[model samples]
Target: MLPWIQLATAKVPGGGELRLMRRGEEFSIRLDANELMNSRLGGSEEALATLACQKLAGRPRPRVLVGGLGMGFTLRAALKVFGTDATIEVAELVPEVIDWGRGEMAGLYGDSLTDPRVSILQRDVGELIRAGAGRYDAILLDVDNGPEGLSRPANDQLYDSRGLSDARAALRGGGVLAVWSSGPDDSFTKRLRRSDFVVNEVPVRAVGKRTGSRHWIWLAVKT
Candidate 1:
């Protein structure tokens, strides 16, 4: 059996450290004891893009915003499903994650980062949402373990009413806001409706099969 090796470490804003670890061919990014993402597990993250892209069919030159860049799963999925005409912007708060995509985890990312239709920003996704109104065809958030913040305290605001409102305002009419979570959150579903988004909760398999841990993807459309 191969032992896990520490590849690199980075500090998260608001006090937390992310450690990148590898065991044979598998890699994982962890915050303290919690594994935030793994190179081998990105089914729900990929679903977060596809589900939202499905709602965007027929929308010309669609523009999408992705809140996280964990191993490029969502970004790669979005690039494939959103078409070549579509433009995708990824706001990754942590810089090291981006480095990982281009460096240690390059195999998992492939050429997704260098795609001409995609842009990578080192800023927080919330700032971009707050600054732009009706700016995107879809806003996909796979940040911080769902609506509940795990790595950073500020991530909690992204799922709050005000944050939800900002996300709504950031989207074009009929645009979708998709969020990926490790589990279900009934309260968050209710809050999405209260924020004026028509919400649907879809369950997904972590390994993209019917036999793994169930994750949730929330598809909330702005009417």
Candidate 2:
């Protein structure tokens, strides 16, 4: 077995550090001791964009805001569904993650990053959500493990009442706010409903197959 090799490290905003590791052909991004994302298991992350894009289908020139750029799986999946006219704004707090995608894991990202419809924002997703109202047709968030913060405490605001409200306002009517989580959170589901979003919780496989740890996706539509 090939031992895991440390490729690069990036400091997380607020605190902590994220280490990029590679084992053979597989790559993994870790926040401290916890694994954030693995190159091999991207089913749920892809679902995060696909599910939201399915709801936004037929909309002319759909605008999407992707919170995190984990391996570019979600962005790639969105690009597959959207056409040349669609615009995707990817907000990644850590710049090194983008570098990894353009460097060591360039093949994993393919040309999604260079696509004309996509814009890379090296900033916080929460700020983008709060920047304007009704700016996006779909807002996909996969920033943390779940609603709760892991790497940065500031992430907690994104899932809180105010954050959800900002997200709701940021979406056009009937637009979707899809969130990818490591697991389910009933309270967060309730909060979505309270924020006036029609919520649908979907269970997806981490490996995009029938057998793997189940990850949850919250597809909340602005009502």
TM-score of every candidate relative to the true structure: 0.98, 0.98
**Alpha carbon lDDT of each predicted model:** 0.92, 0.92
The digit string of per-residue lDDT tens for model 2 on 16-73 reads 9999999989999998899999999998899998889888867989999999998988
Tell me the tens digit of each residue's lDDT in model 1 across 6-114. 9999999995999999999899999999898888888888889989988877688999999988888899999889988999999999999899889998987888999
lDDT of 2 at 25: 91
Question: By summed lDDT, which 10 consecutive residues of candidate 2 come out lowest?
Answer: 206-215
TM-score for candidate 2: 0.98
Q: Over all chains combined, what TM-score does candidate 1 have?
A: 0.98
Model 1: lowest-lDDT 10 consecutive positions: 205-214
